[model samples]
Target: MNTEKTSSQPAYEPGGCLTAVARGIALVVVVPVRLVWDALGYCLKHLWRWVLAPLARALGWLIEHLLLIPLRWLWEWLVVPVARALWWLVEHLLLIPLRWLWEWVLRPVARALWWVADLLVVTPIGWLWRHVFAPVGRVVGAALAWAWGIAGRISRAVGRALALVLWHAVGRPLAWAYRVVLTPVGHWLRTYVGRPVAEAARAVRAATREVWRALFGGPR
Candidate 1:
């Protein structure tokens, strides 16, 4: 038999009540925070966009037009002219007499002293160097050259002897040892040890690839 069912209200949930209370509390808490945040944001935006920005622009304009412009003008008009005048006075008034004195008096005296020195000291020294020292220097230089040539010949002979001795004693033995011992050893190692290692490495790589493929179902 079919029973007639009455409509029943859903059961009240504590979670929904708690969620609504939490939402209300959150709204109460967040409203003031959002309001304060918005107020501060508005204040900062306006402060920067209107007040501080304009103030900064005005300060920049004032500095450029008032301070820097005036300083530049003063420098160009007053300081530059004064500096030019000072330079002109120093060049013409102060330096001209000194230059004239130096040209007329000091320069002439210096020239006369130079001529005397040439006549007395330099000319004699030059003559001695040309006539006396040059011949002695030539002799010494020739002797040195002869000695150097002899030394070079002796050195060449000694070097040749050393090279011959080394060839017989050291170089030939080293070459023979390398050819007989080291080359054979290196060849044996490359053939026996290196080949086996390479083969083993290849086998290991193939095995690893097979295992990886088995596990991952692909090469990657």
Candidate 2:
């Protein structure tokens, strides 16, 4: 009787091809965006509160007290005397323009609204006389389409003018409110959320620094 010898199985390489492929995919998908965000977060932690925030506050204060205040007084000082002198000179000039503008602006808007009302309400009623309410409704749709085109143009012009007025009237005041009145809210956010985050970041940075110091043999 002949006995056959059995061969031993070869050992598998741990984390061979599939592991490399998964690692490559992770590097490609995850690293760059994560690095960028982390860098920004790090900078915000180390830089923003410690550096730029004070500058922002200082600049805002400088703009408010140094620039805006002096300009306001100068404007009041110059405007009063000039207005008195040119009051009669430009009285007729301004009166005509003010009257014309006030008269014409509302007139155009009223005319547009009236035209729309006649087209929609009046013309639809006229169509109802000839046909049913369905046909009248169809005519109203077409009239509304025409009115929309005209209204769109007029509204764009009005919106631009109104935007400038709103910007000048409300923008600075809103900014001031946000800077001054909202300070407590900002401080609360910083105290509750931001301070903890910064503290965590400081811990992380310290740990990273220690790790780097160990590996590279230098202080971070």
lDDT of each: 0.96, 0.88
Regions of model 2 farther than 4 Å from truth: 1-21, 24-39, 89-220
Write the residue-wise lDDT of candidate 1 on 86-159 in tens digits: 99999998899899999999999999999999999999999999999999999999999999999999999999
TM-score for all models, in order of appearance: 0.39, 0.28
Query: Deviation in angstroms for 162 in model 1?
Result: 55
- Compose the digit string of candidate 2's lDDT tens values, residues 1-220: 1233223544577778789999999999899999999999998887988889889999999999999989898888987778877986677789778878879987888899999999999999877876887777789999999999999999999999999999889997898899988987999999999999999999999999899889888933
Which runs of model 1 end up more than 4 angstroms from their true locations?
A: 1-31, 57-66, 95-105, 122-220
Q: Worst 10-residue stretch by lDDT in candidate 2?
A: 1-10
CA error at residue 166 for candidate 2, angstroms:
99
Best by TM-score: 1
Clashing residue pairs in candidate 2 are none
Model 1 is weakest, by summed lDDT over 10 consecutive residues, at 1-10
